[model samples]
Target: MDKINLLVTISIIIIFIALFLSLFLLTVKTAHKLSNRLFAFFLVLTAIDISANLGDLLAISLNMRIFISSFFFLQLPTFYLYVLSVCYSDFKLKRKHLIHGVTFLIANLVLLPRFYAVDEDSKISFLANIKSMPEIQFNHVLMHIQMLFYLVAAFMILRKARKIYLENYAGASIESLNWLFQFTVALSAFYFIALVKNIFKFTEYPNISAGLKIGLVLFELIIIFWYLYKALNNPGLFRTIDSKLKLVQDIILEEKNSNQFTINEKEHSEELLKLQHYMMEEKPFLSSSLTIQDISVAIEIPVRDLSLLINHTLEQHFYDFVNAYRIESAMDILKDSTKSKLTILEILYDVGFNSKSSFNTAFKKHTGYTPTYYRKML
Candidate 1:
């Protein structure tokens, strides 16, 4: 390998280690059982992806044909894992997912004969001599078909994730889901790009193999490692429709009413403090795209708990609670002792209100007057 490839490989190894450690510590330290389990699933699948490819790049005592043959087997499971990990919602284990592994094993059985032959002295030569003659490679065709299924499965996951992210505009886990969705989509696209470059190598495309290896394979390693880093370091990158899902699941699984179960006031205060900090320092509310989910992520709280706390504990709904803060800040801005030349509209957005109409409606709802009337009174 060239020095650049060596550098790239080392960097990816470092990142993979970091992700593994994050996954480890998160698995151990997280009090939330579901989060810990899902994170473990993420780590296991990512580890499989990395480990399968590592045999190729690292030293091994296998002939080139044997190495290539094993790689073909390895690639199947790696792609299957990519589909499975991104599709995972609940941390619950399923027996059906085992079928993918079974199929991968069965595929190797069919492929094993062609790639390995017992020589006259019973020594196995793991090279396909059929390539020297015009011969039908039926199992290769079957492997291609299996790969297509993996592609379809991954694409289906991407579609579902996209729909959930788009439809759950009000919910919080959308951002996390979006991160997984984008990464999945990007990885799939890169794989397809690689596939295309592989196909075009014979069509007068000079250096197509090199281009595919560099742009598709090595870059895939980099992107997937980066993905692990993001997902491990920021567990929020795995999006579940937490509020709705929790409500549904809670109805089924049920929670015991412990009289001792009280809202943590200190944690609540800390979250509100974080929200206040965001409002003061970030001004995210002016974006109109802002929602309770966004705040939950920003505050590092579960959306289901955040919603319940906002409604039952705070005795306020999200909209009223947030708009109150916006309006109060706007009030301070409007009633400033210094002469203010900016319009009420400018002040509204400045205070994180998305529009003049929303600002006016919110001000009137809170204090029984429009901004103009309130400003005149001030």
Candidate 2:
């Protein structure tokens, strides 16, 4: 088969996979129901967009192809909402979310007078000289603008989620946040390539445009497979942060500027010593799912004060502060001759680490050696 025919076949397979995954996400039993549904909707919209690329191969009518193209405006917005849902546990679809559909509505309205209101023959003719059609140009511009806006918004949400996760929690949650961040980065790269492909579509070089289209189909196939692997192998890969949680830096800055707030260096130092003593004696870091709030209540310190002491005064993220203790505990156990027979996994679990990868990372970061290597040196 010719390359175009091969790409068309691959596109068909990708569309099927996307749809199948969408169905799976929609029906899968999980705590992240809203996130799953939003992601499922995003996949359905992606499948529709991919199907639009097969219009010529499928012998779809010009008007139908144009209608299918309008769905592109919704794809990025749906993805942005999915990112929000995954990042914030408290995210709920409200009336304000409908604003995301504005571009889709406007695109359809643009086509209403020019293409959708006309006969099939007129649509064919209009598509024949689509380069000259103002409505078509306007819709293309709108699609690019919407893509840029939503991609930026999605990335901002992921960044904020990462900061919040680092400041408020510890353990394998960072791995899940990193996975989501990497996925968003991959999708952003894909969108960038798609943008280039769209730009190439209007160029004089048909070969480059066709090549980009084929490349995009292959990339989409790989991305879908990657998604399936992560979804199946790591079903619990995404953990949510409360949307109400503010970054420690923001809270510190707000307090610093507030006239009602005053610095008590002596009291702060006492609290720091108390916190360190509590950490060492109580060993609350032994909880894999430990949070700043948990520490706050245990030590009778307010959450805000604890955050300030750990994040601002100590200049350490809550995640790192907690993991430091866990790593230190693991190191002592590793050095003990009595625990020589214990596996690295056992030590990690005993020290409150949920994932071996995270444990190894923290170990290496703290001691400049892997857990096994550190244990062997003893």
Candidate 3:
């Protein structure tokens, strides 16, 4: 019995030491301010949590009560703040958000007396709460309620996070963010489940001591360090090109090399000019998913220069460039008496538009009329 106790004490201390180091390292790392602040809050919670466990191990009932009270009380506030921090884009913290914490505090305070442990007759021995008969029920109905609060906060974070980074390359970054952010949510979920399980086996598994609870807290600490390390490594997210100057440098270098290569391939470049002949004679732009880059590649022209030429000569963005071809093809289709029998949607699909909505949107934007209206007027 004494041997088991000693090992538990030593194992817990080691975990707390790592927890402190992770927090210290996180403090020094550069990050988005809201995430840093929220993570710091979690670090503080870990410290309190460590104290709660250590207090119980020491059998210092007074210290243990203080630690639990403080941890649980502050947790109500940190819960929503952590969510706000994770999902925060504008970094605006409002007074209204405090209501979530305040509401929890008031509810907890009202039920505070029931939290103290009952005398020996009661079965809830591990946690000395208001479980004593006649005074208050031992069952922690409030804890279950708190679990609901946690779920709501975590779910909100998950819901809001989906929209932040929507660019083609941002999917991986979002995945990484979800993995890290989900740690807190996952911990809360485990704690809740273990708690429910504890209630069911309250008599038999007193020895188990909520392994999942301890594990979740430990996991939260470890997750902080892992996230902090990744944050430091990725000053800018992977492949997202965090530096504007780097993008400009790439564009200039690419254009310079394109000009040099074209000069070297003068005869071949002259043959490449056959693209104009093909577009006029073959009308290949009628194909679906054909963008300016596809055309530039086919004609052996530098995409950047082709874009430059289009912008200087035609004053249009790439989106508009593609749509112009689609719209012209739609016009050509409309002119044929046999194809006139085809529906506007069919014509749009035949012209390579992947969706009716997209076809209508692009056609209207380019030709100042919806496909149906354009066909009607023509």
Candidate 4:
């Protein structure tokens, strides 16, 4: 009815909508089934928490209120496990995971008579006389401590995961987890603010406490909306850990192969010759976005074999190896007097260099002179 209540109600409603959409998106949009399922269940728990908060605000029935509040202890652990799921490629929900539900069970048992068995009016009276009960204050303190522990643990998981990712993949892309990290950090800030607000509750500066509480709610609402926008646009954000692990494995295998000679050196050498022939004839590198994977497929060689041939045998990275052929082609075009009328840009384009700067740089690197200077010398 009042502005403050209206604001709170609106924010809660938005959070509800976000939870629902996030659940649906996590299940239907994302391909990472295991992690997605875990995250979806986490959202379900969060929705239950929000429902409990709504029930309390609306002064709902005592039994229903206590049932919802019992879920409070389950939220942090579920979320902490979700972060682990996101990080570890082999993560699975084991039997030991039920330990996380212990607090919820205990909370429900302890609240059996205090809140759950009471009538609606008596429940409201109990909430009003909360200061008379030290147990409620203790529960709040324990919840804050649990929340802080999991927040730090989640960060540690991500930090370790990031290190593993970089060590395994030479060209590893962190784009998928980058937004997730932002959301995690924002959520941590929300928890920190709530903790501080509770600590300074009875202080003279009530405005600071009120402002932080309000800020935390607003922070949550804004992030949920941002998440919705990101989810819609970047459905690949939750790619399977298996897929990520496979990529890392491929890179590591390639690197290892580069260190040792293949047993079938004759066959591999033949393949390398064929690969060079294929590149010269096919000119796949002309495509600006060419990757080792693409060339490997075209040349009918395993990506690791191709990487080994290029890096160890030829002593060049894939990009440089391809660019060398492109430069050689450009040189041929430059030396051909029949194409004297063609502009240097035209020659670069015809030879498959995508941009002028790239053409100039590659030309200089290979030829010791810029395209214009080389053409002038001719």
Q: On residues 79-186, what C-alpha lDDT tens digit does candidate 1 reach at each position?
A: 445444444444344686566565446645554444434343322333334333221244445555666777677667555654433332322344455565566667
Ranking by lDDT: 2, 4, 1, 3
Residue-level lDDT tens digits of model 3 in 135-182: 223224555566677667677655444332321111234444555456
Evaluated with TM-score, which candidate comes out highest? 2
Candidate 3: regions farther than 4 A off: 2-11, 14-26, 29-31, 56-64, 76-79, 111-130, 133-139, 167-172, 209-378
Clash counts for all predictions? 2, 0, 8, 0
Q: After superposition, how far is residue 65 of candidate 4 from its true place, in Å?
A: 1.9
Better structure of 2 and 3 per lDDT = 2
Predicted candidate 2 versus true structure: per-residue lDDT over 1-378, tens digit per residue: 488687878889999999999999988899999988988888888888888767556677666787787888898898889888888889999999999999999999988886888888887788788877898888889888888888888889888998888888995767877887788788888888888887878878767878888888898899889988988998877888889989987886787688546679999989999899999999999999899999899889998888878887888999999999999999899888998899998999999998999998888999999998887888
- Candidate 4 per-residue lDDT over residues 1-378, each given as its tens digit: 354675568557765775787668565844466666776676666666655435336675566776776676887788888777766667888999999887778767666677767777877787787655565776677778788888888887776565444332222124445556787888888788878987766466777876776666677677667867876776655542332433334555675689854357898779888987888788876665566667778878886666656765666655567678878888888889998889988877776655576578778999899989998999
lDDT, model 2, position 54: 73
Query: Clashing pairs in model 4?
Result: none
Could you tell me which 10 consecutive residues in candidate 1 have the lowest summed lDDT?
243-252
Runs of candidate 4 exceeding 4 Å displacement: 26-29, 52-59, 117-125, 170-173, 202-211, 240-378
**Candidate 2 residue runs with Cα over 4 Å from true position:** 56-61
Q: Indicate the residue-level lDDT of 150 in model 3.
A: 66
Global CA lDDT of candidate 3, please?
0.54
The regions of model 1 sitting more than 4 angstroms off are: 1-28, 31-91, 115-148, 161-169, 200-207, 237-239, 242-378
